[model samples]
Target: MTHIQIGCNLSYTVTQTTSFLFNIAAARTLQQTIGEETLQLNPAIHFETFTLGTEGIQVYRIVAEPCELQLQYHAQVELYPDRYDTAEIIETDFQHLPYEVLPYLNPSRYCESDRLAHFATRLFGNIPHGYSRVTEICDWINANLDYQAGSSGESTSACDVLIQRVGVCRDYAHLAIALCRALCIPARYISGYALGLQPPDFHGFFEAYLGSRWYLFDATRMAPVEGFVRIGIGRDAADASFATIIGTAALTTMSVWAQ
Candidate 1:
């Protein structure tokens, strides 16, 4: 069993009535045990809590007036990663894949698998299929793309990242997910607090459905996959954004930690 402690703090200034949705809680799963979770609000505004998908991606919604809005969250949990043998993880044909995995093989807002089909095939088609093919895709991405902070915008997509060859962690993940899907490997985006990530902060990664289970892969390779604590999962970043403000709000301070 692995124990982890994580915390998130944010300070915002609101001009008028603003609504905010937060997805900064540690996901509770059979593999992870959540303990001592806490949330603090400066003005103590009432909030409703809900979860998305079967994994219970926690979301908290609240509305407050013009004031210094401060929110802090802390949690302790344990993560247990499943181990699989490489030789046993054969690529399952489309006919055998589960219904949920089918959607990930299609295109999405940030991961345009359809548009990159030609390119992904021409470059990676010759490689042996299964985990080897997926690894090649990740290797190609790491070698070609330059990891530059603040290089990509919210509107950037997988094709854009391929052309520019530079992006943050999310961009790397988007490109990887697109290529995996083009090869008929079901893949999805994931967000988490990387335990050993330097310049510590929330991180983005991808998982490919291999054999009969989903395996994690990080294109950035900045943190050990086993150390990642999942926060959200979706086709791309659009579904996993940490925060969404409906009205006017200026973020004055933000901090994240994993220990």
Candidate 2:
């Protein structure tokens, strides 16, 4: 087993200064098992509450606030532990919890679930009921999608990327999730920080389940390697958003940097 230190820094460059509602600041770690808590070192900088969810995972949620919105998160995990490697980790069944995720997984008219299924079938065909199929899906996504930033944003959907054939990490993750769900595979979106050598220090990723075990996959980074740090998980970006507010704010200029 190898122990590693992972850190994620996220910042938002606002075009203007305005009051913004922020959430997802709450940070929690998940252990190898659902019942245990993964060790977390540094606590959140500015947060409203820190609590454990029903699944026994740590969570951080922020409330309405105003600022330049520069946030940094750091955590350490034993990567590729003797008990857990990429193959071993991803080969297990995903923990099924559709009851907890269905409401959030519902698609809108613009991105209907049925439409997504048809689109994904063009590439993945009928979703295979095995790990090999899942791996194939991942490999296919990596092979087909080009990893470029600023191609798409928060509202972009899988179909949009399918047509354009270009997108950012979030777009790739959304595309992957849509494809998995279309196959009746329960999948979820993950929002976290990825260690990069450049700015926008954090990136997005996704996870899917085959049966009971949840396997982590990063369509943005392609795979979790040395510098990946997790922040949050939900059905999609809508559920995993870092900040949201009912009121309006003019975002003037925002900047994010990480290394």
Candidate 3:
């Protein structure tokens, strides 16, 4: 077992904060299981209501009164009883899972001749068979893709990142997931905090399932290390955004800090 700590500092400035709505908060760890509610030690700066979304993703919604707003928040996560050997158990649990549990695995969404399959075939060409293939793919993504914060925008597609050769963790995960789903493998997008070494900060990571077990693989970090905290899981990044506001708000300045 291992113990890890994670922290996040998010800050933004709004042009006109008319009822500022935000969704920035830590997610309960998977160790706590689905549908379980637990208090976090580092609370959010503003009061927010928790909402559950598909695939165990949590949403924190906060509404603030109108004003020129500069908002900042920090979160810390301590992961305990960290057993990395859950791969076998995860595989076994899903071996006999009903189709209802994984409707996204339906091949109808990705026809046999679809681009997803083509991409997977290309990626799988050099990889040896079995779990090693998944590992190789994850490692390849981590090594090939550079971690840049604003390289890609919200509207960027998985294919776009593949061509650009640069992206954030979410882009890498999306590309991997697209290929995995095309190959009839079950994959999901994960959003959460990764504890940084210097001063501490929150980043994102992802996990994928091969055969009977779920393996945590961070395309961003590439290697299994300490301080990876999970916030939510979903089909893709669109399903795992920290906050999505409808109206336009110009972010003038932002800053983040952690201890």
Which regions of candidate 2 are displaced past 4 Å?
1-26, 32-47, 52-98, 101-111, 126-128, 197-200, 222-227, 246-259
Provide the lDDT at 114 for model 2.
Answer: 63
Candidate 3 local lDDT, 31-120, one digit each (tens):
533232332312233655655753344555544443444444444444553455433432223456556437445332212214567777
Query: Residue-wise lDDT of candidate 1 within 94-206, one digit each (tens)?
Result: 99999988999989999999999999999998898888788889899999999998999999999999999999999999999999999999999999899888888889999
The candidate that achieves the highest TM-score relative to the unseen native structure:
1
Model 2 residue 245 lDDT score = 48
Clash count per candidate: 0, 22, 3
Q: After superposition, how far is residue 89 of candidate 1 from its true place, in Å?
A: 1.0
List model 2 lDDT by residue over 1-259, tens digit each. Answer: 3343444344544344334344333244443212222222222334444544553234444433444455544445443412234343332323455466554345542234567776667767654555555667777777788777787866688788877888877777777777777766667776654545355544667776744556667765543434454556666777656556444444344343323
lDDT (Cα atoms) of all candidates against the true structure: 0.91, 0.55, 0.55
Off by over 4 Å in 1: none
Best by lDDT: 1
In candidate 3, which residue ranges exceed 4 Å CA deviation? 1-21, 30-46, 53-58, 72-76, 81-97, 104-114, 125-130, 197-202, 211-213, 222-225, 255-259
Global CA lDDT computed for model 3: 0.55
* Model 3 alpha-carbon miss at residue 126, Å: 7.7
